[model samples]
Target: MKKTMKTTTPITKTLAAAGLAGILMISASGLPSAHVHAETKAAASTNRVTAPTVAPQLVTSKTLQSKEKWLETNIKIPVFQGLTDTKYQDQLNDIIESHASKDMDKWEKEAAEAAANAQKNGYTMHPYQLTINYELTSDGKDDSLISLKVITEGIGMNNGDPRVDTYNFTNEVEAQRVTLEDLFGKDYKSIVDKAVKTAIAADQDQYFANEDGFQSIDAEQSFYVADGKAYIVFQKYSIAPGSTGTPEFAIKLPGKGSDKKPAAAVVKSGAYYKDKNGKIMVQVSVLRQLQFNVKWNGKSKTTEISKGAVWSAVKLNKDAYTLGKMAPRSLGSAPVMKKGHIYVPLAFLTDVLNLNADHSKHGQITVTAAK
Candidate 1:
């Protein structure tokens, strides 16, 4: 993502928006004045789990002319989970100071504006709400976790109103702390392999052979498993006026609901699943609709899906080609079949079912069973 200065100014109060609080106090002859009061405050709360409220204090007050240079300060340093208060404060202070020099006034103005807008809309805005959390890893180090919440007041505007627009930016960065001491007798890799195999087997039974009977003409071309997910690639060798050889279709499978009827499936386009090595395992397909029903053991379980939903199943096969890397790029583009496995684009499968691809690296791709 490209970082640029925000075009709109954030709302803020008067003098606070200007860099007047921390400027130097000087006499008429440009001599530094000795009568400057730098207000400071230190308070604590009994509850650590809840957010603490802190009153703002004047760090410095003088009549000196403002310069273009940014003034840096360490507002608060939280030390927890085996981290020293001073060290943590120093590190945070350094980061703030370094970034502050770039455009301190700009940031200050943005912060003030944001606060004012938040209040005008009847929402409470507190500087302390910007508190960040850091976790101390086993390596005796700490990493910052960016977590903030934005609250806005309710509006009575109609459906299409821009005044209610509020953007909340939260950064939940993963910590890079892995321990090798727990790998003594545990075959972590093998465990993952077994999981992948089980997922493939389940998917094959679900999509290929359901109670409705096998819809695939060629069992080998119908479904296959790689990694830990399943993949079902099918093609309709026909075309319509404006459509390509792959006409649009829908996948109606049994939903997990009690209705016992097929519900609309949601599939995402683009890369869906990956392998243990972060290699793309699912590719796009040209087929309009390819349905993968959920099956437990050997019975259909009312769930429906597309090929991209099962990339984990495909990655388990060592011989399976990583989707997109070696497979055809487009439908009617080239043959995706190699040996006995079928290679289809994940996008085609996802589009048919109206599902979004599971692009998350560590999150589960939820597939709802048909109703």
Candidate 2:
């Protein structure tokens, strides 16, 4: 007799709670293969498990000159633990080296710059404070997403205006960060700009005068992925009045038209949902289009997907890996197998199947193109 098994958890609710909080605040803030087989529900009901609750460590630094003296600083930063794969580890290390440390250094430099300006102007520098907070927009076993919001204010030291900016990073395709091109295919730039313009037009009063000012979005523009949606974050005066203060918009296609060209790849969309208990839940979809072979063993079920020499496991309801064979790894997010489709993190696609993936279908998802 064929056996069946299923797994569910409240963690999805936790993710939704976290993401919805950030999404509501847009006004203010914001893979691998492997193979095996399954254990039917009748056999494995007692063995169900949930993905790990991602708790990235934070490192804080504070300095004081004197209670009354000037130049006071405070900084908080996040450090992510490396997933099991080496390729993934390298990516994590790069994120820390390039972003984590660089941001902290930037805050420190600001203190120095402020002190210098005050002394030169013959005015006493008050105390300065910088608070950098991080929000988990999306987390998955194969694909994880997070954003850093940096707020630096020189209260007594200066006029006390906070400087803010946000950065978005995705570990897709195993080649550092997810490029706009990789997500939206080749013409992503122009298509994105047009999309943003339409959104601006819909809310004409919220943006600055002259469409020229809000005409485009460069590759380096500020954006974040939360609750399965892309949010384009603009600077204080980029597209809106200063009072709008860091206005943000959800990137959406215009009436299903020119934006018709889909992204090079569809990633985990960050959409928030509520469970029967009314608790918010986050549902993330990885590469549902990717194909994998499944097999069941005497104990549990296993799913395997591969590209070239690299093979990775594609288990649902647990932390999977990008290169299950290259080394031990986990995607940090949970994937689920519902009906016949496997919803997984995009990490499995780029890290495991990228170049080898043929993806022949133009408008729809393509499966295995090669070995």
Candidate 3:
């Protein structure tokens, strides 16, 4: 987002809001709003996971003075302690330094050009500034995953959108870079597309329409993993108005909290019965509790389930079902029609939709939508 610089003084503190001269503000604690999660005391005891904390050290600071221009630069790098493999740390340092050096040079050139113009036109010039700061998203201690968000802000002739570069690394000896597919598997693209679209759907008016809005996340989309979720980030004005800042959607990461016992379903009232095959069959309408829209087509005798960009189709007495454009897979048991309602195998939730379908001792099925 665009952060305005007030006057020409050196910026020593993180940005805050005021008026046109206000700059982007980060939390005083350096924790992003996206990382905040609330859990009950009982649940916290059962599933306790803490992110690694690292200290940041100021590495570069420079200032330039001239008759008509004043410029300042600041850069800080994170310091990792008790690390066996230093490749990840070394790589991140190099990348941040490289970016800072390039930006400093560019800002210097822009300042000189601006100063010359001010002298000729007899107008005062504002200070030219560049600053690079970082927030630690993840460290490799607990999950062998390291991620960081590096923020760069420049102020000279105009206010520009902050450039954020996210670095994700696997804590291997060689320090391999992590990709969306590596984190979410083969269906990474589809999974991200559905999650982003669903988040945007929450307020479509906040974003642009047609082609100018979001089309799809690229294979190399910007992301960072934190709090058992991978967040997909969009640049300012890329998909929405600047007032929205940088939009990010959190996708539940695979295998997160799997070791811990599944929490009780928040809302667990659904009609389900066990068929002769012993497979739990749930009424198609029950999916509504999990935020799925179910539609019945009498002309084609098909049932469609949709959530944002993801959809699934199944037909009566059909042994197969299709999810999105993927090939059809056997449902193990075809949908059963009874009492003017359609009941599909529990696999419809656990297998096809990738939801959590847990059976309690009392014959009730606990359905939980993926976060």
TM-score each candidate.
0.16, 0.47, 0.53
Pitting candidate 1 against candidate 2, the one with the higher lDDT is: 2
Best by lDDT: 3
When 2 and 3 are scored with TM-score, the better candidate is 3
For candidate 1, lDDT tens digit of each residue in 185-247? Answer: 123233223432333333332222334322322211221111111112122221111111111
Give the candidate order by descending TM-score: 3, 2, 1
Clashes of each: 45, 36, 0
Per residue, candidate 2 scores C-alpha lDDT tens digits across 73-141 of 343333334332346444443443343344344545556677789889998765555443333344433
TM-score of 3: 0.53
Worst-scoring 10-residue span by lDDT in model 1:
24-33
Local distance difference test, each candidate: 0.23, 0.40, 0.58
lDDT accuracy of residue 184 in candidate 3 = 62
> Cα deviation of 268 in candidate 2 (Å)?
23
Per-candidate RMSD vs. true structure? 25.9, 18.1, 18.2
Where in model 2 is the C-alpha error above 4 Å? Answer: 1-69, 85-125, 142-175, 252-371
Candidate 1 wrong stretches, greater than 4 Å: 1-110, 116-128, 137-371
- What are the per-residue Cα lDDT tens digits for candidate 3 across 164-190? 666675453334466676566545687
